[model samples]
Target: MKKSFNGNNVEICAPAGSWESLSAAIRASADSVYFGVEKLNMRARASENFTAGDMAKISRICRKSGVKPYLALNTIIYDSDIPEMKRICDSAKSAGISAIIASDIAAIEYASSINMPVHLSVQANVSNIEAVRFFAKFADVIILARELSLGQISGIVRAIEKEKIIGPSGKPVRIELFAHGALCVSISGKCYMSLAAYDTSANRGDCYQPCRRRYIVKDEETGFEMAIDNQYVMSPKDLCTIRILDKILDAGVSVLKIEGRGRAPDYVSSVTGAYKKAAGLWNKGRFSISAAKKLEVGLESVFNRGFWHGGYYLGDKAGEWSGISGSAATLKKIHIGEILNYFHKAGIAEINLSAGGLETGDEILITGHTTGARKMKIGSLRIEGKSAVRALKGQVATFPTDFKTRKNDKVYLLVPSS
Candidate 1:
């Protein structure tokens, strides 16, 4: 891992929407995991958020695995949300949460009053050194505005050190950057398109993502309408920095955050693992162009709206808009079936094929709440004690495996995209 100016290794923070994604992040060697609980977070409507009751368990899991857990309470807070916010913060503090990622002043002030560590969320749109110094009074870490350039970020980092600005922890404030994930066309993701259209405020955690859809431009005077040409104009491509990760590390960032709390467990696992490997390679001066390309291929196999560096980091003003309405991942998952039983001693898993069939040499992914995400290839298969090359739908098949899979774990076959 790349070390920041403070000599601490840069942290890789992954996102978790569910227990499965949390486990997957840990399995992929994430330094920390951030997640939403209840409706007080930005991904509240997009993900299966944990309840306040789940805080202890989540903290315990992360503690046992040596991964820090950050509770995201960064949505726009209303007066009615004060009680719930306080309850959640109390729960997090009691549960030993590492930190709270917050944007609203209400959440930040309450968290500070309770003496709990806080990390400024991107919603705060902190862009300048003065903003960092101000937030440093309440937070130990600050995620800079996504619109800032590398030169700007470097300047802020330098100012933090030169100005001797320290956080509530009495240590130098850490800077975090969004290393990879979906990019919003809005400035620092503070858009009100959802609220303007559907009465659902994106700031309140219920984003209707009107930007991801196709739109038609209509002439109000002439009643002439024309569809935009093959582009989701408002939706920018997903941000990918693996190619320029060394430059990011050189900027003295203390944390690399992967944003996907609403995505699948496998997506978390794949992206976190890729960044982890890339960071390690970078520290050893082995992050060559070929290595980055290989890691990028692994990334493209997962969920993405097409990859772009974004003008924010490179200082290009033009937008890299998404051409498609959804993911342009190179590989897609096909639901095959679920595991019926696992014969531990025999190292075999009995599966009931409910949908698609599986053939030898086919790669399969097994995902579950406890199992997380596990991928393996089918070397051989058996059906009713007879050796078989393929297991069709409705057939009970047994396959040898190295890892243990739990009952009801969904299985998927990875296939090439059309």
Candidate 2:
């Protein structure tokens, strides 16, 4: 698929922790989706990692949606892990994964053996043009280190183009950067705090997030201990570049990636949807400050960690991290109703309207384990078997839908901003 920017194609890669997230990303207009394999992916514990069978299913779903699926083999590996790695590579190849993001050299070699397109993971920390040039020999795409500033990224891209360093595809190595999501206090893939605190390697997909924990300061000579001024001193606020997206685009990156695989389908939808719209406007030179503020508000409405900043992309001017709580202050989503039953042939779904009643003409998103966020307007609503304009908070309502809704699926009313 050709991902376009402005009039040119550029990818808007979204995270897929589950099938619901995958569907949400696609519906939100993500150009591509990235997910992890079971057991060996960086988000193995955080996400519902795909099994071999699940990979084939994912491939079909992505293909049907016209979105490319990239496998995340981007985790530390051991010598004994090669066999499982190769098996995964073979499976991903058969499943038609667009590429495999790998951090370990052995994992890269194994993926290369299967002729899968390799993307150097952010774990590799490709900061300089020299590193980009070196990886160009093997990797089709390079996910630049998160610590890089726009100036640094621009220089690297220029140097690569000037040097004519070609990737496996006989074209310049594609640059992908994290445009939104959680920011790690430690450098990407270089942290040993998790290892020291939990005896689990962060690189091996087993981080216990020691950085998000409170710590006490101690003076060894006096043998005195004092609580830190702020508890979550290590955690940084989440990254939100909606305000300076055009500057990021000028840095010559091909893909803008959102970083939330452990997040819900709603999160994936809201974040990706906002960025997708903003990037399109930016490309067309139609983006404005008012539009950016609106987009920022929409992003915060989904989930956030207090506030946002440009992160390392703005260099030291990005300012001090404000997230002292080491946790996301996600907004509480309003509940409209929950699915009770569905009369499939009748194209009607019975919902127990418990909170915030729904009115006719209101926009809603239906989400569940199997029901990937389906968005539609309430054309009609019935309460207690009677045609009604609205369903009260305590009423059991039924509504006609174009898609089948499963039991337990949640209905969220999308209220227009005043």
RMSD of candidates 1 onward, in order: 1.2, 3.7
Q: Against the correct fold, how does model 2 do in TM-score?
A: 0.88
Q: Write the per-residue lDDT of candidate 2 for residues 1-418, one digit (tens) a residue.
A: 2233222466799999988899889888998999997888888878887787788888888889899999999888888888899999999999898999998888898788778999999999999988888888789789998899999988887787777788988877788999999878888889888889779888888888777666778899998998655766776778888888888877778889999999888889888999999888877778777898888876876656755567888885443565455334334556877999999799999989878788899878789766777777899988778899987898898889998899999888765433
- By lDDT, the best candidate is 1
TM-scores, one per candidate: 0.98, 0.88
Candidate 1 regions exceeding 4 Å error are none
Model 1: pairs clashing at backbone N, Cα or C within 3 Å:
none
Model 2: how far residue 254 lies from native, Å: 0.6
Tens-place lDDT per residue, model 1, 8-91, is 887999999998899889999999999999999999899999998999999999999999999999999999999999999999
lDDT of candidate 1 at residue 363, scale 0 to 100: 95
After the best TM-score superposition of candidate 1, give how far the Cα of residue 318 lies from its true spot, in angstroms. Answer: 4.1
Q: How accurate is candidate 1 locally (lDDT)?
A: 0.92
